[model samples]
Target: MNQDDLFIAEDNPQKQIVIVAMTGHMLLDFAGPADVFNCANRALELRGRTDGYRVLVASPNANKQVTNSAGIEITCTYSVMEVSGPIDTLLIAGSNDVQNLDDPAYQDFYHWLSAVDQHTRRVGSVCAGAFALAKAGLLNGKRATTHWDRSRQLQKNYPLIQVDPNPFYTRDGKIYTSGGVSSGIDLALALVEEDHGKEIAMQVARRLVFYLNRPGFQVQFGNLLPVYDHQNIAEKIRSWMIGHLHEPLDVVRLADHMNMSPRNFTRVFHKQTGIPPAKYVEKLRVEAARKYLEDTDSSLEEIAERCGLGGLVSMRRTFLRHLMVTPSDYRRAFRTSLADVIT
Candidate 1:
């Protein structure tokens, strides 16, 4: 079905939502999305309508309750083998226990998961659940994310998959993946918005007392400056860049500060950060400009100068290149509320 067909407005057809849980699963990873969908059903019922979703929890082991990472035991409604679909969305919950993709014990479960994907309309993972999806070969060539700590491992393990560590959630075609624990709520909200209208999703969010919609592209980590443990020379240079964003910092200036040649500085910086020096500088500048746009009512030119983007045109282009949105639009979307602003 097309994207339009996913939305259920008046008729409110029941969508089948299957959550796959495993041993050592993160409770919130499964429960967060469960709460969102359950609340969405309640919202529908308040309008004298039937529930829009049929939620089922399934597990690899059918006979016993699965013990989560938190030591909570939860019973599954069905085993993976029995949960044949017409599934609207199949979500795999994360686990704390490190997974080995090539382990013989998981081979059967992996095969079952791969088969289930064939019949599911949309398949996704919450946090480190991405490991299982990658193991099943479902995430190959797809843009995906997991917890911040696990993203590098995911990328290293599945070289074919594009692992983006920053987003709250990512969707590439019919596959989706979310970052860390609470981001499952954001992913679920996006799914609700996709399956119903924005109004229903907003109602669900309000009921849950959560942000209505945090765009998936929003940065997962808030620090504009890179964190370092030992305060190495490269880290010191990065700290200087953050403090001196308003200056006209070029390769020569940065190299001089580090007392190294421009070529050597660029090479070492890239080695330490996995990004080129120029790109890192642009990222920091854009991140600083983003905060200014969200928090202050400064003119674009003023923000540009303060964030060291040189001018308004440069800032605009940087914002577009890095964030895929204009500064004005980002401000409109993420600006603090008037009530908060007044206080």
Candidate 2:
């Protein structure tokens, strides 16, 4: 066995996992999958097996120190040019903004990445890292995804790639892409399942305290809402809406609060938020109900009323429409206390 990259944890490895982080990468995107593969090896050892993944991180920074988005500096010792050997997986960690690959250093890394594709079995990206992969033409004509907010920009920039915005993750042939920061975990778990088996991945998920390995199509929203920049017009109304979610939130009511006619308010709201007034109200209600379901021991009817969904039927319908899962199932999945499940 030859070493081409530095290890986070290495012992009798069967597969080599490499994560590449550019300067200013999102920390979670780099750490999440690395932990997953490391845990996979731990799980395998617990089962009295020797064949498991060896995980390492590679960076493109000169000093081998990549400062993350949170302003914390992490020293990666090995640059992209230094990485070599039988790599089973190569993951590109993401950032808020894509690095300019046209720069000479990045250009060198870009070429190295494109060259490594020949032998690397699996290639993946988390969040905005898809931009780098797409720039390399690796995702061309392939079904891929990125962070929800950046999906449109990705599509517009690279028309050759089919970008699906809804999924938490995507896998087309050898290339895999995840929606946002945390979705990297989902993708890594799926990759683990592919490499070992469902049972092994399940063990890893359980060890990581993930009750459910969320499916790719699972909607990516804790709040299921987007923040807007139109502070003068929408921020005030949005804050008010959150406080008054239990109250009636029809377009007429919202319009009255803004001191505008319903028709004019509807157009302005949609233009600013990119969602209709009625739909946005439904989103607000569903988001509230989700919190109640996850946090409290409240009954469905009580939660529905508290969230202004009116009744159980309405709440269930809204949950299905936006979340693609029922309210009860959501609680079982997202309930914070593992002790609650045991009891």
Candidate 3:
């Protein structure tokens, strides 16, 4: 037994996490969670408490060293058939060649995952692995997420799954899923907090030096670009909008500036960019407010004016809608000085 296993033995019942690794998986997806559990063990040791967690690496087959996206080799301790007892948590790490999911080993892995889900406590996926879970029907009718790029494919192939690609992570009952590779750490930390106390989870987070122990609902998709592909006209308009974010550019004037009719502009804009003009403008304005809050010593009213929200009332409302926080608190929480300025 490893140090983590020793720690787990002392707790009422050691939480067992089965990390499912595959051929050509993303190494960080698995390593990141492993590091967190290991760090939890160390944190428990400091408090003179044992029984942290039992993390086991399981593979679909035996004897082969699984290669990750970066070509690192990870050898598992057990095969899927050897997974006994209840798995308190089962995490499926993602792969680079998700297009090759039809491989025999992967097919068996999917079957094994479904069988395991019947006996396991919870099931989850990181990045593209959610597609695998969707294939196995474990994620059917469950609200789940994966790396945003694969969101469309996951939804198209598995119509039963409710795919929300925008959240950094999500939990629906016993099913948990995250947006991308590094986001797994966020999801795992959340699980740790759910199982243990907040203090221990925070301690583990601190030990891991996480950027943020992000809430599951926090937006996974960053600022969506309005310009698509190599369309210079739309790109120029987007650039102008960013520069003059504080100005109110109503639809008529904006369309006039772009040499388009209001209805025609809205259609082309949504068709090309996947968002309406008003929403695109609002997103840009909110993003500007976020930057001003983080990078400048601006008051709420000042930021409101700078972001074209008229004053504090509109700015506060916008912040609350997008960030779920008031302007003042949002600044206090996320504000930081910028190291460089654009010329």
| Top lDDT model | 2
Cα lDDT of candidate 2 equals 0.81
Cα TM-score per model = 0.71, 0.76, 0.76
Q: RMSD, each candidate, Å? A: 6.6, 4.8, 5.0
Candidate 3 lDDT over residue span 319-340, tens digit each: 7777667778766666673433
Candidate 1 structure quality by residue, lDDT tens digits, 1-343 = 2433333343557887888786787788898999999999988888987757988778765463678887888887566656555677999887766563344655667888887667778999998889999988899999999987788789998899999887889899999999888888999999999988899999999988898766536352444345655555556776789889999888889999989999998888878777877787888888888888878889988989888998777777877777767788778877767824574
lDDT of 1: 0.80
Question: With candidate 1 superimposed using the best TM-score fit, by how many Å does residue 205's alpha carbon deviate from the native?
Answer: 4.5
lDDT of 1 at 229: 51
After superposition, the stretches of candidate 2 with alpha carbons farther than 4 Å from their true spots are 1-13, 26-28, 39-51, 69-72, 96-104, 147-161, 206-212, 215-220, 230-236, 239-262, 294-298, 332-343
Choose 2 or 3, whichever is better by TM-score: 3
What does candidate 2's lDDT look like per residue over 56-154, in tens digits?
788865567777888898888677666666778999987786645344667767777776778888999998889889878899899999988888889
List the candidate numbers ranked by lDDT, top first: 2, 1, 3
